[model samples]
Target: WVQKSLDVTFEEAVALRQAYLHRYGTTLGGLTAEHQVDVDDYLAFVHDIPIERYVRPNPRLAAMLSAIPLCKAVFTNATSEHAWRVLRALDVADRLEWVVGIREVDFNNKPRLEAYQRLLAFLHAQGPDCILVEDRVVNLRPGKRLGMTTVLVDATPEEEVDFAVGDVLEVGPLVARLLEAQND
Candidate 1:
């Protein structure tokens, strides 16, 4: 689909995908910038998937999420519908307060200043008020620059990340610690 969408050969598509990802943070961002790609059409086409086949319901994750007192949201570069499906598959669709997708920020994907600004506005939040928990270090960099407490989900924490956890499940404890520190 990407090959046809970009009108490039298979190898060209792979290279372009990497280049776009490195340069624009998202291929869609580059596609729209360099090519006259229909954002809606492309997003819908790429996101069409049998999510249930890959993901199973995580009752433990759902329970952990529900136990948190503050409102939680899934902020992603992906489409909102895709996020919803994944959340539903995890049995945690009801746990989150909202899902902030690329469309929500008017197609401004993560690692973009506009994306973070838009998200902060939507949440009526200051950078310091939020905790950004992500698996990718690149994604956390911008949030850290904006004063967000960065929690790297993977064990290897970089300098930009404030905390490290082996898995997302461990994030609950780290978040609690942050809340306690803030109160003190």
Candidate 2:
């Protein structure tokens, strides 16, 4: 798909995608800017993941999220529909209150200030009120800079977040601990 869309060989497509990532923070952003690709069409085509094959309904995760009273949302560069599909597949669609996608921020993606600014404004919440949970250190940087208590999922200890968890299941306990600490 990437090779055909970029009109290049597989190897070339990989390199081009990397270049775009470095230049635009996202291949979608670069494709839209340089190739004039339609955002909706490109996203739909690229993000058509077979969620069921890779992700089964996680009842444990659903239970954990339900136990937490925080206002949950998925802040992603992917389309809202894609996020929704993943959440539903995980049986946690009802857990999140919002799916902040690229369209929601007018295509300003993560690791960018405008994207976070726009999303926070939409939620009527400031950075301190948000606890950003992400796997990537780069994505968590902005969240930290904006005063969010970042949680790095499936990662080793890092400077980017306040908490680092080896698995998503640990997040519930971590959040509960944080709340307890705050009350203390």
CA lDDT, every model vs. true structure: 0.88, 0.87
What is the Å distance of residue 84 in model 2 from its true position? 0.6
**Cα TM-score per model:** 0.95, 0.93
The candidate maximizing TM-score is 1
- Candidate 1, residues 1-184, lDDT tens digits: the string is 6799767799999999899899899989889878998888989888998999999999889877876778898899999899999999989999998899998999998889889889988888999988888988888888888898888986686777899899898878777777788799
Off by over 4 Å in 2: none
| Cα distance off (Å), candidate 2, residue 59 | 0.8
> Which run of 10 residues does model 2 get worst, by summed lDDT?
32-41
Give the deviation of candidate 1 from the true structure as CA RMSD.
1.2
Displacement of the residue 178 alpha carbon in candidate 2, Å: 1.0
Encode model 2's per-residue lDDT on 1-184: one tens digit a residue: 6688768999988987898788778888778778867677788788887988898899999999998879999889998888999999999999989999999999998878888898898789999999999988888888788899999989898965788999989999989998998999
The C-alpha stretches of model 1 lying farther than 4 A from their native spots are: none
